[model samples]
Target: MKEVRFFYAPEATITEELPQDEATHAIRVLRLQSGDEIFFMDGKGAFHRAEITLVTNKKCMYRIVETMQQEPTWRGHIHLAIAPTKMMDRVEWMVEKATEIGFDEISFLNCRFSERTKIRTDRIEKIVVSAVKQSHKAWKPIVNEMLDFKNFICQPREGRKFICHCYEEVSKEDFFSLISSVSQEESLHESDDITVLVGPEGDFSIDEVRMALDNGYESVTLGKSRLRTETAGLQAVSMSNLARRI
Candidate 1:
């Protein structure tokens, strides 16, 4: 038996030819030839099984055999907003892992104590695409540009909102416990979109935490152990995915 491989192609159905990047991988790297069976993900909750009709020097064209609309593994939207670390590789790793874990969206925060204020969302998008393909996820996570902490908190959002900080001054709830309790009360049919905010290495400034609280974001703790920025982001996504698992 042969293993099935999936490729990222946002316009898979609209266009018969694979995107440049995907075409290069299929034709050159994978050495795929005419009449080969392949699968494509449109990154919008659909998967297409196709047969390669033509392969040229730079293009791989295919005809769709079947189209499948997939349901997500987890219910609701799981969004993670975090302050990027000074080292970009850490942030990239978190995005990759989170996408594999099946999150809906990710946003970067420019906090008061943020070590790295600038972010290249294009680079992060590529990482997300690769992860989605590898994980065989039907939906692609949205990668938003970095926003100031103050502005991000002020933005109107739906569902449950939380801010994770290591502040003893503020009363904090255990995130996992809260999520579990909520799940027990409501039926699985009810979907609650959740957004979790995590700060940088130094954590969110007390003032920033207060601002978030003022904007109706709950203060929460991941666990007893202190975690790095990247780890905290991954943990938040993981917990949300598990709680919302269907």
Candidate 2:
């Protein structure tokens, strides 16, 4: 049996053809010919099994053989909001890994101590799409434009909210432990949303932390060792993923 290749094509259907970029890859890079089997994810929790029907240098047409709806492997919606690192590579790395690990949404925060306040979401979204295809994820993660620290923190959200900061004066709890407790309390559904805020290289300003706290975002710690902005973001996602296993 041949391993079925997965491609992202939200608009693909039983009659529709693969998109130009996907078609090009299928016909050129993969050297796929007519009758070769492949699958496409709509990035909305659905997958379509397809077979190539026509191949050209710039286009590859396909006929859908079947449609499959996949349930998410992880529970709840995991959202990570972080200040982009000074170096774009670090933030991009985090985005890729987090997508593979599974997350629902990502927000870029513009914080007081943030070294980089701007981000090109177009490039980042492409990275995210690539990650989803590479990871075989059925649902696409929502990537948002960068927002001011105070503005982002004040936005209304549901489920357990947390902010990771290094201020010792402010009481904090273990990230994983809080996740566990939040899940156990109130007999919450396994799919309850979790939103975590991670700061930049300089970390969130003390006043910013205070504002987040005032806005009902609990203070939490990844661990004793201080983490870089990108690392902290990934750690938050990792801890949340683990918390669901309990």
Candidate 3:
């Protein structure tokens, strides 16, 4: 049977009835019939394999056939602090792709050079859900509230940390190089736990870069090409995971 996945905001489980909107989507949109199989998640890494027992315009009830519980992820931890772009669409795209690529935590830094001042929460969250479903991933990324640029840069980062920046400084290493040099420990991939910072479209100021260094973040470059804020962030995420594949 084809599986339909839905995100329930309230609460959910193998026993709990799905919310109205989900029921509508399953019954009205997907034309899910009784006894059909589907999947639902609480977006907290709890995945339920459900079979439709009752389907109605107002509500739907499913019997939990299987329950796969996942711990809240810190696995392959990738946290990105990015500067919002002048065009909000870029940032929205960044969120969608980043979610698809998989990141544990995401934060926005309101950098001095940031062209875009405010973010549309509705738009970004919408992208996140679609990407989460598209990638068939059990976990979702937390899009944090915007941080003060200077304050953000000054914060200490636990575990392995790198700040992707442009301009000549110490010779920058390819993300793959950094990912490769770390030796794997136990079951976990080495360097799987990481945090990266990508600045805004306008880019981070000199002071911001300095603040990051003060906070223990190593200044690294992604390459010679000057990438947009969103591109840099997404690329870092992609590389973070792809390193495991290589």
Candidate 4:
């Protein structure tokens, strides 16, 4: 059996040529020829098994042989709102790993102690696409531009909401415990969309935590040890993903 190369074609149809970027990779990098088989994903849970029909310097066309639509990996959407780290590589790494683990959306937060205030969603989104293709996941995660902490927490979100922080004065509960309790209570529904807020290196200010609590975000802890901004974000993603499974 030939190794099936997967290309992201969000607007793919039963009979159409691959997009320019995909075409370039298919024809130039992979050296795929006419009659070769490949798979295409629309990043909306649809996969198209296709056979290459034309290969040129600028175009790689295909005809769909079969279509498969996949179901969600777990119930509910996992949305992670995080403060971007000072190092761009760390943020990129988190996005790549999180996409592989499966999540619905990611948002950047501008917090009181954030090292980086601006985020380029365009660059991070490319990471998302690459990770989705490499993982062969049917769905692609949305990466949003950075937003102020107030704006994000104020936005109405459905399902459960949480904020992870490290402060001695603030009362907090273990994240896993809260997940178990919430799951038991809402077991009938597939799963409720979960939104988790992770703060920066210095953590959310006591005042900021107060604001989030006022706006319905429950304070939770990842564990005993403190975590960096990106690590905390990744951990929140892992915990949220695990919560839906229980």
Best by TM-score: 1
Taking all chains together, each candidate's TM-score versus the true structure is 0.95, 0.92, 0.84, 0.93
Deviating ranges (above 4 Å) for candidate 2: 183-185, 189-191
* Whole-model lDDT per candidate: 0.92, 0.87, 0.74, 0.88
The model with the greater lDDT, 2 or 3, is 2
- Count clashes in each candidate, considering only residues at least 3 apart in sequence or on different chains: 0, 1, 0, 0
Tens digit per residue, CA lDDT, model 3, 106-219: 888788888866777667777887787667667777777788877776676656778887756644667667765665564363345778888876667877787777787777
Error of 4 at 90 (Å): 0.6
- lDDT at position 125, candidate 4: 87
lDDT winner between 1 and 3, please give it. 1
| Best lDDT among the predictions, by candidate number | 1
Ranking by lDDT: 1, 4, 2, 3
What is the per-residue lDDT of model 4 for residues 5-33, given as tens digits with 9 covering 90 to 100? Answer: 68999888844899898899988888999
Instruction: Give me candidate 4's TM-score against the actual structure.
Output: 0.93
**All models, RMSD in angstroms:** 1.7, 2.2, 3.3, 2.0
Error of 3 at 49 (Å): 1.0
Local distance difference test, candidate 4: 0.88
User: Model 3: residues >4 Å from true position, as ranges?
Assistant: 1-10, 69-75, 169-171, 185-191, 244-246
Worst 10 residues of 3 by lDDT: 1-10
lDDT of 1 at 140: 97
List the lowest-lDDT window of 10 residues for candidate 1.
182-191
